[model samples]
Target chain A: MELVRIQKQDFSVTEEIELVKAVSKSIGGVVVFLGTGRDISKSEEIVRLDFEHYPGMAEKKLQEIRVRALDNFNIIEMGIVHRIGKIEIGENIVLIVAAAQHRNDAFMACEWAIAELKRITPIWKKEITKKGEVWVEEHP
Target chain B: MVKIRFFAMLKNKVGQEEVKLDVPENISLEKFKQILKKEFPAITEFLDKKSIMISVNQEFATKNTMIKDGDEVALLPPFSGG
Candidate 1:
């Protein structure tokens, strides 16, 4: 939960922030990006979503992104956790938390990490709907 | 025997998560893709170079990338997860 975690269980935002704060020293700002599943996509009512990731590769890519952020920014604590399996509408699916001595580093590193994670990480999702299903092929 | 892994809709179309591809040694990723094209011709649109991405040994690969013995290759569709 400190660096990188990919799990099926839901995560506690409070616990995550506390851990980051507990571990880091003299951090001025903290930025966290919490991603949630939506009730609708493309105007279709999505009941829930089934998330699948390429086991080993997904973690590797996530760690790679994390490392790149560490190298580029002056961040102190960084944690990226993504949840798999079935996730309901409005449920949290992923969390990105970055702590830094400066507010800019915290915000920029947080944004950059998620952008890279969404771009390359091999985690996938299938939106299950009453009309059947849809494979979500793109992300924001 | 090289292992070809699939994910998401690609896995569903192939009816499984992975398949063993039998091929000569040192084939380019492009050629192996052609082999896959012949094997699962039903979903050729997913095979388009623009739509699909290849990872060799867990690193994103290009068409000229070579496949070696016992390499792990994955054909992925456009990723859609946060």
Candidate 2:
């Protein structure tokens, strides 16, 4: 199954993988990348994170990344999901699953997908600290 | 008229998500930006930053890109997504 979505609800990795496996039985390896919110940054304690995205363009860019990954890598199929709105610390932020005939392709595609998402996706995060709210401008 | 959308810190600083300006037809993105700065005085500094980017019709655009009626333009700050 091919999935490219932006949502506010939490997702189940097992369910997503099951859907990916349904696409082809020849898939021998699957690599899943899950990015979660951490509580600490630059010695400050983060209470929560508010994620904002450009409504129509964010999804369009995600789909573009998915297409590029499929064409550039040897992966058979892939799925991507990003959570938006208010998220508590330790919550999931994004998920990427790359399915391929071998472990190398899955691993490579999964890494490349996450990097592209960070580089081009029109999503931003505001860190709510005990001191105050700060917009995270740097991509690290 | 062209619609300009703001997001993240730019939205907070500008105090609105979007605005429609009655700009002249076939104006360059740079010229439209000058008009936007005059209209929204608070975003002048942010607009000058090299990190800030512009998108026309949902794709990344350069200053030389031309703008016309009904085009959707977005002023994007640095992307900090995963």
Candidate 3:
């Protein structure tokens, strides 16, 4: 299956893992990382977060990350899914899953992929707080 | 012509998603910013704050990079997505 996905729909960890494992019965380890919106931002209460992405470019960057992760790690397969548009507090925001023959490879690739995705992907979020709106800053 | 795209707060601030311009060949990225500042005055303040990043043809670009016609240049605010 194609690994990179950018959609507004929420994702499921179990379903994602099933998709990967179904590809190969030899897969023994699967690591999944799920990110969700929180209610607080810098001590302020947030009602929701509005996620914006450059549709064509963001997907391209994600595909690059997926390719790099596969090349660097021993993982057999990987998946990346991110949610876009306005999301309420506690809603699912992103999902990543890695499958490998062993636990170490699955864990390492999943961690590295998520970190790289956060660093380079052209995705941004706007916080809708009680005090009004604030665009979140990239840490890197 | 080259297309310049804006996203996130930059899009809201600029009041539009994209603009296409008939840019001269071999214009440095820094000089391109000057043109944008003059044309879209709303982006001027954001540039002063260093709150935006530019990408040339979907890749992060340096000010020294040369830009030409048919390239897609995007102006982005700091990304906050996870």
The candidate scoring highest on TM-score is: 2
Question: Residue A133 of model 2: what lDDT?
Answer: 97
In model 2, where do residues sit more than 4 Å from their true spots? none
Model 1 stretches with alpha carbons more than 4 Å out: none
- All DockQ scores: 0.88, 0.90, 0.76
**Distance from true location, Cα of A94 in model 1, Å:** 0.4
TM-score of chain A of each: 0.95, 0.97, 0.95
Q: In model 3, what lDDT does residue A100 have?
A: 96
User: Model 3 compared with the native: what TM-score?
Assistant: 0.92
lDDT of each: 0.89, 0.93, 0.87
Highest DockQ: which candidate?
A: 2
User: TM-scores of all models?
Assistant: 0.96, 0.97, 0.92
lDDT of 1 by residue, A1-110 (tens): 45688999999998888888787679889999999988988889999999999999999998898888889899987889999999999899999999999989999999
Q: Write the per-residue lDDT of candidate 2 for residues A1-140, one digit (tens) a residue.
A: 34989999988889988888788999999999999999999999999999999988999999999999999999999999999999999899999999999999999999999999998999999999999999999978
Q: Where is the poorest 10-residue window by lDDT in model 2 chain A?
A: A1-10
Candidates in descending TM-score order: 2, 1, 3
| Top model number, lDDT | 2
Model 1: pairs clashing at backbone N, Cα or C within 3 Å: none
